[model samples]
Each structure stands twice: as C-alpha cells, then as structure tokens.
Target: MLHNKVEEVKSREDLIKFLLHLRKDLQTKGNAWENITLKDYLEAMEAWVEDMDGYYLNTNQPIPKQPSWKTIADILYAATMYE
Candidate 1:
C-alpha cells in the first residue's frame, strides 16, 4: 500500500521513487484520486502537515521531531488522495 511506501521513505532517492510511484499511480488510477487539482493538492498538503503530529500520536507512532525526506514524502503522498 501507499502507506507502507510512505513509511519507507528515508532518503532523497526514496523520495524520488515515491514521487515516481505517485505519477504512475495517477496515470493508472487517477479516476479514484481525490486531489487531482493543484489547488486541492496544495490545500490537502497543508492540512495534512498541520495535523500530522496528532495523527502520529493517535496512531501510537513516534511523532517526527523535524521535517525530513520521509515526512515530506508522506505529506506529498497523502495529499494525492487525502480528504
């Protein structure tokens, strides 16, 4: 799942791979994606980042203390379809 892929992001190369995967996913499943427009995608990204710590705490995951490639990738990947 994409969640797994997002969790696996730890380096620049991984971020690049995740982005490529997102492109591929969009090409294959764009109909099912919610944030198709740039505006929606950016908004979702902002909202998701703002609430990311709460999500981690709620899910019993360690909250990221600093923004890293993984966190950035997670935000981008989530914004692709997150409501």
Candidate 2:
C-alpha cells in the first residue's frame, strides 16, 4: 500500500511530495479533493492514537508516540489543503 511507503519516508520534502501524490491517487479512485477540515484532521489524529494503543496492547511494546520532525512537517504541508 502507498501508506507503507509513506511510513518509511525520512526526508521532509519527499514526504510532502508523497502525500500530495497520495491525494491525487485517491482522487483517481473517486476520492474528492474537498477541503479537509479541522474535524477531519482531529479524527485522523485520534485514529492514529487508537492504532498505537492497539499495537501496544497486542505487542506489549510501545509504538513511538512522537513522530519525527520530517513527519510533523509533512503533516503541516498536508494541512495546507484544509479549509
């Protein structure tokens, strides 16, 4: 999946480009390019937290709670598309 590639990205610019490409790919799959709202961003963050919790509970090893600086930059770049 594209998400797998995304997780492996270490460079900020590369991650931003990948995320933008991902959005376009989704659009090709019938996902609209509507403005992503704050609610949408929050929901995504919440889902990530839940995923981390589940992984921790199953493996007994905590997944990294803090994303890398590059990842945070990527998130901010993605947020620019929001309404």
What TM-score would each prediction reach against the true structure?
Answer: 0.89, 0.48
**Model 2 over residues 1-83: C-alpha lDDT tens digits?**
45455556678777777777666655674245333555776565555445545644675754556876445543443443333
- Cα-based RMSD of candidate 2: 6.0
Candidate 1: clashing pairs of residues: none
Candidate number achieving the greatest lDDT relative to the actual structure: 1
* lDDT scores of the candidates, listed in order: 0.86, 0.54
Worst 10 residues of 2 by lDDT: 74-83
Name the runs in model 2 displaced over 4 angstroms.
31-42, 56-62, 69-83
Per residue, candidate 1 scores C-alpha lDDT tens digits across 1-83 of 67688888889999999988888888898888899998999999988988888878898988988889988887888798778
CA shift of 15, model 2, Å: 1.4
Stretches off by above 4 angstroms in model 1 are none
In angstroms, the error of model 1 at 56 is 0.8
Clashing pairs in 2: none
Whole-model lDDT, model 1: 0.86
